[model samples]
Target: MRLIRISTNYPAYIQNFYGQRSALATQPYAQQYQTLMADCYSWADFWTQAFGKLGYEVWEPVGNAEPMQKMWAQENGVSYEPKTWLTDIVAAQVKQFQPDLVLVNDYATYSRSFFTHLRQICPSIRLVIGWCGAPYSGYENVFKAYDLVLSNIPSFVTDFRTQGHKCEHMHHAFNPAILKRIKQEQNTPIDFSFVGSIYRAHNFHNQREKLIKQLVAATDLRIWANMMQLSAAELKLLPLKQQVYDLVQLLKRLPLGQTVLPYLPKLKSYARMTNRPGLEQYVDPTIVARAAPAVFGLAMYQTLADSKMALNNHIDISKSYASNMRLYEATGVGTCLLTDGQDNLADIFEPDREVVTYTSAAEAIEKVNYLLDHEPERQQIAIAGQQRTLNCHTFDHRARYLDQLIKKNLA
Candidate 1:
């Protein structure tokens, strides 16, 4: 039993975090890392902490945090160089800890060679678990290396299984400590609020963007997100992008295509984008301009906590499943959530009792107005949702399930 969990934070949060704590950068690597994880930024140290609590010896390293890794290398006497994170840094950590299990939250970034190096350096390693929530087209062979694959989306589970890999479905959970960290007043200020992304005009986010636009036009909704606008030229070529993506995927499945197809750039990126210079035609750029900048970490929790009702919409790729962090995050922080309706929603929440759901934007608008006008019912649902999340949907529960899953396989 020892385990190592690999996770990273958003580049925006990393930059902001270090900016706010300039002195922290000068501290020892251990001290800098301790301060960094104290904010509980993203899922950075969550799995390690959760598994450690259950008496499993676990270590979590922020995988993509290069500055921190460099510090670790300096402190541990591990040599560092450019583009050697896989060869030098991570391999050294594996060789030192000799963990039995390695869980990669951002699995697509690394290749099979990285895992091979780990296996070579640490023969004690038993499982290579990967967490993939989005559709990654270019990382086909990268995924084939995982010992077990996990996704919150049921469809993704099916996709992994169809690709002839071992996969399981799990729901993302909330950290209740967020409540203690971010205090909320009794009287909430905002009537309705939304905190999410609207990156591109096509794919799952396109549906979310469309719904957000309709809701914003119809209701008094305040929004926050980090969005990038696509150029007019890119917008015009979206259809062509879709065609290219389809053709690539189709060819990848063919017997002949398996031999000679090289991965091309922008193959299916237009399908789901959060960065700049992509699909922006989905939503009116004016709304993006008017939107408050995206919130993260504790600020995001405080934002949701202060809102009377927070809206959540799943991406189109979710495909009839309620699979996203917002469900637990919004509800865990004590806000009435009005998310898009999905089949497994009731499995997680009692709908109307714990959370409210809507099938269409028009319906969401109608519910938003009614919830705004009626205070007692909305607060009641919010309270219940928070209770459900605190009681059942937490990293502790997830850790226990993971413990069992890993043990069964080990047995």
Candidate 2:
């Protein structure tokens, strides 16, 4: 059976990833696809490659690669709107490929109605499969579009089945071939680092941000994410954000508080810039000061390989599950992974042996310091963790399970 696998990138990464490839814009689609295949990011083509091994013809299309999409749209005579642009590209590809199943990895771009609309347009489409690892808070009926919904997070599967939707648990895995794509470091110089999302909308990013803030305060922790890019003016005002907050407290003590009330909103605005939640562009100041420029795809893998210990925290939605990509990526790349304590973590890696787990921010800090100081123990865990991932958590293993899942649904 032939199927299609679709992937999307963060708009920032799309710009960052492709903007560097200005020369590729003038090149043909085949060369563009060749360049795309070289950089192994988030699932990449691993799943479909695994599916290919299991004797299925799978076509993987990156829905957000604009240059390739533009060329294909022109060739296929497909017109698209801004909002529906991503799905438009995928639908056109489905029409071109004429596949039985179209698996969408990005739920943000396509909703239930869009999936419904896809089948309406592409009669060859027999199954619509979706994959999500984060909390899905769209319209209540959003998941109804898919014949099967898959998540690495055990909690997400539980939520889906509890809501009476058909869903399955598929753990996230690493592609060891990623190591071949990037240069290997003989020595890991960075002591502790984190390379993932810091956006507030992500399930537990704020809580993750809090833990990171504490870590930054106490340890030599470094972070890399493109989420917060403050302008010169914003950077100048960061220090003032605290002073403005202090001034507001001082003003509150004055008997003439009524007079300054008109300007309170202005003062509080700067305070919220560093302290409160709604400030989307800024992460915590401590992290902002320590934040390195974002790394993606192969750069991310290289960073993981160069770090002695990579920190991981689950989104609030993960709820006692150790299912995020970092669990596999960090360990697979042979870095000691110090992750938040999860109920199912032992199922994946033996505690204090294959990996390290921390129950609280204080414990995370304590364990991180302990691990960094004790290099032999840490390296042993790293070696064991990588072995565990290589043996059991590669995408090839996940592919056999996914193949069964797809066929069962088809049956």
Candidate 3:
């Protein structure tokens, strides 16, 4: 299968092993990370190389210095700059690397035009794939140019398909190397840990906000957040512009234990976040890897080993889907999974059996407290969940699912 992947970066360790391995099926996994545009490792680089090694012809377009140049300008907070030069340069590269499919990761301002230009040049391409990690906007017509759109959310696929385009549900993968690295470096016993941010406070409910606050208050547990929230006094204590940056710095220093919630803003959420500064800078992988690693959550299988209890909550969106990446990760690690109870959650895993679910903030707290006190029951749930992940949810299984989907669509 000859495919072309156009992502921001394709480095294996960073992009969840999309482009590093020389597998049986991979040949030319041509990919590139826009280094001038962003300072982080790119997932595109990893996948492209992986496919290339597997016997696919890999073609990466690098003639576009304009995209990287524009990305560099954006890094310093200059949004008014024109990227015509960058787009022209990238267009030349696109012409050279033309292939059957174009795999897109986050479709931000930096790479949107790149996809549009590719479609203009090659309409007969069998597929153009866009990965959606969230249920937000800017996807209205951006995906219209593509053959398929993929996301973990089934509701998202339903909405797109209803609008008259083909789409599919593809779960995200954990990088085996990163997991292996974390496992090797930390011998610390697993304990309860939560990763991700409590900022974007407006996007969450009062109850959800309360739950986060309560976790912050608990001393027995190691509470972590992307950054510490400003107390009423702290907010009042700083200068306006400086306050935001200070908050960002504070969040960087605070031990989040583990990272969760990959935030790629769709159009509306992007606009809603006007007042929030310093968010764009956090996209770098090195910055992400720095938060206190003693306890982390989010990865489906490897994260469970970071802590005994992993907090799993649904991001407020159009649907309340309970079965998330963390659900599997926590279970797979044999870490006691305490997740928010959502519709259809029980269908995915037996409540209080393979995994445990809670409907309210109080319920979540109570469950965590109970699980901490009852070690034997906690271990039982952990073991069951771990066994389930190992048996059913490995990347190898998911890869086959992708292969099937591709064949069905092509046929």
User: What CA RMSD would you report for each candidate?
Assistant: 6.8, 6.1, 12.1
User: Where is model 2 poorest over a 10-residue stretch in terms of lDDT?
Assistant: 270-279
Q: CA lDDT of 342 in candidate 1?
A: 96
C-alpha TM-score for every candidate: 0.86, 0.86, 0.63
What is each predicted model's overall lDDT from 0 to 1? 0.82, 0.82, 0.53
lDDT of 3 by residue, 232-255 (tens): 564454466456444444444456
What is the lDDT for 6 in model 1?
Answer: 68
Over 4 Å off, model 2: 77-84, 232-281
The most accurate candidate by lDDT is 2
* Candidate 1 global lDDT: 0.82
TM-score of 2: 0.86
The lowest-lDDT stretch of 10 consecutive residues in candidate 3 is: 24-33
lDDT-based ranking, best first? Answer: 2, 1, 3
Tens digit per residue, CA lDDT, model 1, 188-303: 99889988787663445877777888877888889988677555787788677666666766766798765646444544453233343334344577566558878888888899
Query: For candidate 2, lDDT tens digit of each residue in 1-411?
Result: 788888787777778778888888767776777677778867777867788888888888788888888777777788988776777887888888888988888877767787777777778888888888876677557678888999988877888899887899999899988878877676787999999988765665778888888999999998986556576786677667656677766666786864775676766564344343225646777788889888888889999999999999988777678888999999999999999889999989998899898988999989999988988999999999999999999989998988889889989
